[model samples]
Target: MTSSVRGAQLARLLGQWHALPGRHRRPDYAALAAAVRGLLSDGRLPLGVRLPAERELAEALGISRTTVSAAYRALRETAHLTSRRGAGSWTTLPQGHRVATSGLWAAGDDGDVIDLGVAASPAPDELIGAARAAADDLPRYLGSAGYHPTGLVELREAVADDYTARGVATSAEQILITAGTQQALDLVLRLSVPAGAPVLVESPTYPNALAALSARRARISTHGLDAATGWDGELLLGALRQGRPRVAYVIPEFQNPTGHLMDAALRERLVATAHTAGTELIVDESFVDLSLDGAEMPPPVAVFDRHSRVVSIGGMSKAYWGGLRIGWVRASAPLVQRLAAIRVGVDMASPVLEQLVAVRLLAQAPQIVAARRAQLRGRRDALLGALRDHLPEWTVTVPAGGVMLWAELDGPISSALSRAAEDVGVRLAPGPRFGLDGTLERFLRLPFALDEETLTEAVKRIASVRYDLDRGARPTWRAPAVIA
Candidate 1:
């Protein structure tokens, strides 16, 4: 089951390959090789995916075949690519090279390193008491076989009740708990999206969702997002009607990276358009509970779904803690059954103790979320101030909620910035990682989930890296202690 990228697609992913930061205007084979290597390191170009042929890529990129050949040859020599005579070339990692796809490894291995790759924070203080309560509650279920694919009843009721409080009347039967939002998305995609089906997503949506769509071989359609303002209503409606995708994944509330919240009017129109297009909606509400601006939150998109066409996915990772590993999907009861049936074949059920902890956490969510928001507000401001002090040239959009800030750099050097930042003990989530086809190179997503002091230090290091990169000096690369 080898996935082969088309020449046009590869060209799109290699957007502005010639005009990389500190590189000359004229594209050389060395620059091309470096670009591909950067893609591989950042998990953009997954290993083992067959690359387009040199001639085909050359035609698509409007370059000579000789340059493409030399680039491919350089990649092959570095063990970043493998080739057979007729089967074509495929991407691969070098034998001893270790790339931290998630920044946790680098942070754990090096104390000085700051991981801005993930936008999650540590657990709230309420979690410790909840864990103790969960421990006490766990023994009651020990005698049974312990298999609840639709999730534990108490937790489901809690989630459904939370939705109900948010204006969507949800029943316990409509909830299916999974490991996290990622797992819930996977379950929904597994049951809903078929191979080669058209799937609409936001241009700079969640990168992992894009990876899942790619793995499913879905035909992806994207509508661009404005970080300052949310979605353009007319553009999105037009895309829905034209694309007519089988499924559309959207993050209406405090969207990841870009924290723009969707207004209720847009929600109604978008859901109406989806119904007219006969497309199902997968609404991600992972950041729903993290409103920092004190604005009254808009109603969940499900409020506009008259036909149960919208499936809402949420989790405890962002507002609660990533360690909880608790997330659930809110859909029609029948759809929940189908998703649960599919999920049973995959992982049976979420761990009971964790679900118990989530139930307790939900009961105390009000206090936890308020404190979390206050903490995040300070961190967000601190990060903003640091950015202003360290790098005044970059433009940043102030998000109403969510844990990360979307920034526009002065140049299309996000990938280069990431490469250089590693030397300064900082791991960054570059702009292109959130985009499709190597787009958004002029942007970056800086998470404010860390403490104010840490955020200040990370911004300082990043500013230093940016300075070195702008001066056309490459930072000295040092190997991280951890290989995994």
Candidate 2:
């Protein structure tokens, strides 16, 4: 079945479509087509969905119907749209214009390539033991159908206990196990965010969450973050009051890419501000357990929530291992039930064995986390030292915790540097992938999850790439053969 976006919704997504920075002005229709194409390429607009009628969209955008018609025609010529006599126009990718990987998921690590694209660590030493214990514990559930939509009772209890330990009182009934944090975010988006509604996010936030918001057809409003200061309380609160978005998704605990840990005071004020603004807050705590500096962590954001508006998501992927693929949502029991019900239609339930392994892992979390933090600290320092020695001009604020550091290049050459590094067997996730539109072109997120030698070598390779690019080395690529 095909879904359609209405006129006003499409118009909201096409905000200032005709405004192009750093390029010569084009015709209104060409500008319009380019904007839509960019959205598709950025994964903000899902393919195969019907667009609004030209007349309706023209009226919504307050443009001429002829302009909309010409834009649609241009899109069709570019193979970005398809239409039939009865069916309306739907979005598609032009042949050979398939989007580059966003590096939000796992990619094959076969070869000598040093992949700083993904921010996941290898499985810890404790994981194999945990898996063995889980296997031993799995046979008891074999007699059943093995479907636990809400999650296994023991794992739920463990997750709830963790929240309580973090100062948020929770119960087993309040937890819904997801395959990972991404799925937890997806389920919440489906349940809470309606199409055409406004959702607020940080400017350089997680790319996957932006993808999810766009997939839901929600109007994304962005708030900027500071590298030195992290969040501006007054500015963010003002945005909440002005936009009145339906939801605000924040990664307060060692936020992704930026790695700014929200202080307890800021967390309290943020929660109160969202409560006053009547926006449901989705706080991601995936990196909370990876504190490398032995600092006291702030309480979970849900602890400060007076109203039932805050939803907390955590997972073992960041702190433990990505292979386990266990994540959960902490909310009111009623909301948990609602999310579980919606989740059943998606994947039925998370695997039983993984949940069992997650339970054992949580039981060994103290020891596992201690060892992991020590290992990550050494790697992080090694990368930092390497950057300082080889690429001294780049500005990188040491992250308190998290797998990656966001470094600002001296110039807006991050994209070029990433392309050049590919030739030297170093894969990078460029800075723009973490932000809206084409912003953040001057920054790069470098992950230190690899071993010390690998991280140091990757930095050296990246420095060499930068040096060549600074000296006017241009990269060339051959066209990929299309598979017909």
Candidate 3:
């Protein structure tokens, strides 16, 4: 059965909805249909969510039931909504339109396609040994209840010690192990910020973070990052001072997509400014250990935070393996307690075996970091060379670290290119997925985490599609033969 949204809740969510910004003198029904369609297209209204009944929604919005019925009819005709006699209408994107319009993409199921959308690599050989070791230690924990909301004590201590080694004095009480960085972010946002509160985020930031903030119905304010200069301190400070957001989500070290590392001085200033503005800063440092230059990096932002306003999230996804699914949040002890309580309602606790494996993996962090650095550096160089050779018109920055490159295309056809590339055995995330609203259409994120051969072949296919798009060829939208 499909979950249903209450009329009051749906009305609250639709409070910010407005007609599309155009000069067309459309009827009220068409305008309302377009507004809801925009929400569905951008994922604000998730698929399978049953909308409020026409009469109920009309009453809530102070509109006539006839208008609401017409709007529903329009949405139904366009396949954005499906209705049953007594069950009311539910939100959904037309089958073929889901992927491209939703701004999310994945590889094909057949193993014959290259997916440049996600910047993830395979787990290292050490994972097997770690898992085996964890199994050997599992018997000891069977004597007691395994539920640990705050995470295994051994893993917490390891994470705390890891922070201490990095120049930040931390204790186990200040750390809460999470399923992954994503969960850490979700927990923090839910506990610290209320719905409709203003939240600051970097433009063209991680798409998943944006989606999380959107899910909370937060008022998002963006501070743009310069591809050449990285983060703009003044602009960020101005937004903090003016917007006075309740939270600011940022990726400080080797930021996603762009891979721009925040300098130490600016990092300190940003934290101080946020403290003065009463903004809680959530810093994601998942890629901090993947520096390709092997240079000594700046300390974590938590080191510069004196007011307990910054919460740093660290994960093994990028450094070691995404499958590890282990991450931690370093904050004040009280904040950690609050997040743990909130997490109880979410997942109850992270898996015990994964926590055990994480402990062993933490012991071998130096080796893992070094290996990932070498592997990603080689792939980065290879992808750069391929792009320069095949798609010369696209301008891209050579990121010093991180697994992806944010490249600006010669034309604003990222969405079209992504749709067409799928037909040629390649899947790409359109640029607009990384930004708020429908911005960043002229850019694309190209991940180099795959094998060199796969990267080469993917780039070849992308180049062919790019050429076709440049020649005025449009994509023919159809359901994929296979979904992965």
Best by lDDT: 1
lDDT of 1: 0.88
What's the distance in Å from true for residue 426, model 3? 1.2
Misplaced by over 4 Å in model 1 are 1-7, 25-27, 50-56, 76-79, 82-90, 102-110, 474-484
Cα deviation at 265, candidate 2, in Å, is 1.3
Model 2 residue 176 distance off true place after TM-score fit, in angstroms? 0.6
* Model 3 C-alpha lDDT per residue in residues 204-264, reported as the tens digit of each score: 8998998889889999989998876788888889999999999999998888878898888
Q: CA RMSD for every model?
A: 2.6, 5.7, 5.9
Each model's lDDT: 0.88, 0.84, 0.82
Of candidates 3 and 2, the better by TM-score: 3
Q: Pick by TM-score: which candidate is best?
A: 1
Tens-digit lDDT string for candidate 1 (370-435): 999999999999999999999999999899899999999989988878887877778898888887
Candidate 1: C-alpha RMSD to true structure equals 2.6
Clashing residue pairs, candidate 1? Answer: none
**For candidate 1, which ten residues in a row score worst on lDDT?**
101-110
The sequence of per-residue lDDT tens digits that candidate 2 reaches over residues 1-484 is: 9988888987876655554331134578876886676556444567898999999999999999999999999888878899897788999865544444431111232366787888999998888888899999999999999999999999999999988888888999999999999999999999999999999999789889988998899999988988767889888889998998999999998888899988889788888988888899999988999999989998888989888999988899988988888999999999999999999999999999999999999999899899889999999999999999999999988988988999988876565567667668787877777887666767888989999999999999998888876455423332333444
Ranking under lDDT, best-scoring first? Answer: 1, 2, 3
